[model samples]
Target: MALTPGVLHVTQPVDGGVGAYVAMAAADQARRGWRVAVACPGTGPLAAELDRLGVHRLDWTARRAPGLSDAVQAARLRRIVGEFGPDVVHLHSSKAGLAGRAALRGRVPTLFQPHGWSWLAARGVAAAAALAWERLAARWADRVICVGAGEAALARRHGVPGDLVVVRNGVDLRRFRPAGPRERAEARARHGIAEDTPLAVCVGRVTRQKGQDLLLAAWERVAARDGRARLAVVGDGPLLRALRSRAVPGVHFAGAVADVRSWYAAADVVVLPSRWEGLPLTALEAMATGRPVVACAVSGLTELVTGGVGALVPPGDGAGLAEALLVRLGQPALAAAEGVAAAALADGFGVDGALDGLAGHTLGVVAGVGTGAGEACSSSRLRKTPDERGFDEHCQTPWGQ
Candidate 1:
């Protein structure tokens, strides 16, 4: 008799992209008849979604940043692991990656997903320490699942040695489809915006990583050029109040909303001036809604946003960012054409495919452990699903293979 496969997903962030990813993965695995449990904060979107799905949730008390309480958190995680007895453990984001890996120490088949590298969010001495920790922690992770090729490239470039696999972020195409004219008009009306308004929507947590501040700075140039242009900064975070205080005219701070689809539909263009990303879900959602994107030429954004779909200016270039937005907002015909192209490109990246690929990798890792082969599974053996076949250069074989 074989035991049922079990997976435990641990994450610190209970909202935003990381939280959403965990919820989706847990729900998918549970529906497949696998024993799946998510250990995360009891509040936020992740918790709410898990509750709605009737998936098991274990309350995990952890902070968003490294602190003295990490050891305590790790101990709690160890207890959870011992009690649940999962076949595999998946840690999402930096804080969970840190504590979970530290607790398990390769004792279990652990998958660490950085979401976005921690070092990218740090500065000066903190950045160096974060990078060093990642390199040392690589030994504990059976596989470092990067959400994008650029994220995997960053790991290799920074010498974070381990089995690196890329499973690009995906969107639910059913929920996010191209908005027709009537839908657009209705969305605009619901948002209390005029149908003819040249709106550029930015949807993400209001943080330095998301670069909402940079987008606001660029919006000055945009507003100066076209006073009729409107910019809506959706979502909320620690910097929300500060950003709102400094917001210029025509810039609306929506804080946070239950649904972002209406915002995408209402916009002529979507903007993401993120400082770093491991393939942001907001960008994918926007593209799936048939909205052109104007984003920073950063790792994940560069991989998705092409000239035909939208514009990618050099990161931190305010003038360039402003110019990109101007081009789209000024020409409705061009933006519409690019949006069509964006939706076409986004068609290739569906949530089902991404989840299926991840499922394949998880099963492969478990099989390797069962065979006492550790992480030394062959590429052919791992590529069981059709989605896994499209991983391209993003997935690599184990070292010494």
Candidate 2:
């Protein structure tokens, strides 16, 4: 009998976007009759999701950041790869991209998705080292898949070379349909938000990268104009306590909730002030719930939040962020119109296309085709990053153009 095709996804930080991405991919691959396995710390919501999906799990004692223990972890991952016999190894985020590549060393067809480049998150010596490693590690990947065009462009800008392909992040649409008034009222009541108040919900970790502080600063201006407008910062992180303490009137920290859809249902508008992203799921999820978004005009948001579907302000620009939020929150009619457009845009980003694209890419790599860098989806559109903002590009645009 022919050996079954298998793929192994490896990552650290088993609670955030990276973890969620891996879980979704592994489950989809498994459901399609591929032998899929995931190797991570395996001790959080993602682990539980993987268990539910029936994807083989390997315990990897990997740290969020690089440490001396990387060698040991790499060895463990190598053993798992050997045991699982994956034809393709898909590494998610920096931690897995590093250790998985180190373990495999081009012995297998490996695909690396940075999620967001690590150099963007570090500084000084650490940043320099990350850039250097990324440049060197390009040789290890059969293909480098980016979740957003900005991620691919940023990699090139930093001299991190690879066969880059963009596969925009997607969400499950069935679970996130537009909320009716009854659903909205229940969600708002659960969160202590008044049904009639203009509410902006931000769903993400309370971290510097997520720009919660920027949102808080912007919220001051928003509240100054509309006293009834409320801001809910959902998700937990290291900065949670500090952010909660500094929050003034009209700001509520919901911490982490199991079902974030309820929060989306409660919102008049959704916002993300991220400094960078590989197409944040918060914006996608909110759009799926038929809500307009006000997000920093960086990375992935540039592509997804175009036209009147939502508004995008410059990164780190609190005043601009505030203005965008005010436009969405202060004008209910405008927000409602944008919400309709948002739902239309989100209709193009259901999980099926993304899952199919990833599967195609993996199969092509395993078949010895270089990079598997073709268009992931015919419907996927491309948008320029801030530096090249006015440029019109299509999804068919070749890399390095």
Candidate 3:
């Protein structure tokens, strides 16, 4: 009468970055012969991918933001946990982080990944409440897996105590590899962009966080300098209507496309004008496609983008963003050279290594080895001294202590 070794991933947002992370982790775990179940909203791209991967799917109705109904969601999650009987429960983002911990209360091995701290995205009263909850509920999660060093630092600065670990985001190299001549031509043709035009593509939701408006402000300057320069903002969100209303002539809103690789292939430069991020997958996708990027110098991005590979400017600085974009578009030869360097660096952060690191951490927790500090809790190839592990130095105290 022993419980089977299984992992259950629970979350609310079933699209975008959190969705991608859940699908990748579940599929990787399933491939390794572990019984994996995902408890999330029963629709969207994430659910479809999980079904394709043959993972057990449990429908959970939860809102993106917290409310009184969280009690209902927590109850539902607890019931799913009972049925699945997993040894480990991985909570993704804030909604699931709250519900999963409340439901499980450390009854099972719990791994909570905030993706980005909730308070960072909130303000005033909501922000204070979020920080308070994170600090108080920190103990409910046995381990906290931060997606970037910036996120980890923010947690410490706000005193969200826990055993923190960093796992930088990565993407699938095979699917997002560099485009050949035929691909470049075909993708441009499909998107109806002239081959000679200098194209800069920004791929992400049209939200304040993604900074589409900031990019638009910069795009005005970029188009003024080079009339043939075109900017495409791909992906839709709550701000889509508002963003489109503010768009200038050279800016095109591509909406949401199934295969983002096609857009990446057609681009001369990829830009992420995010106000904040936990290492955007869009930048990695563009780099993998052998394109240089111009992005804000935010937490997740600072870890990945460097001067040789791409240009990083201060967040919300429209002038700075425009300057960086001009730097890439004005000198095609330099941009192409930087693209080569970007691809080389991006290859080092392939999905395989990330999958392995996740498996090691989850397996360690189930085996009761998670009580030790950081990598000492896991026997995966991810093990290295604190500095060598590439985590923010500020994260040392919580994980080490």
Backbone clashes, each candidate:
0, 0, 0
Instruction: Report the C-alpha lDDT of model 1 over 289-319, residue by residue, as the tens digit.
Output: 9999999988878778876999989999999
Worst 10-residue lDDT window for candidate 3 reads 378-387
TM-score, one value per model: 0.92, 0.93, 0.92
Local accuracy of candidate 2 as per-residue lDDT tens digits, 289-308: 99998889887788788898
Across 100-171, the per-residue lDDT of candidate 3 in tens digits comes to 988888898899999878887888999899899999889899888877666776777778888876666778
**Candidate 1: which pairs clash?**
none
Cα RMSDs, all models:
4.6, 2.9, 3.4
Worst 10 residues of 2 by lDDT: 387-396
Kindly report which residue stretches of model 3 are placed more than 4 angstroms away from their true locations once superposed.
1-4, 371-401
Index of the highest-lDDT prediction? 1
Please give the lDDT score at residue 246 for candidate 1: 95
lDDT of each: 0.86, 0.82, 0.82
Model 1 scores what on Cα lDDT?
Answer: 0.86
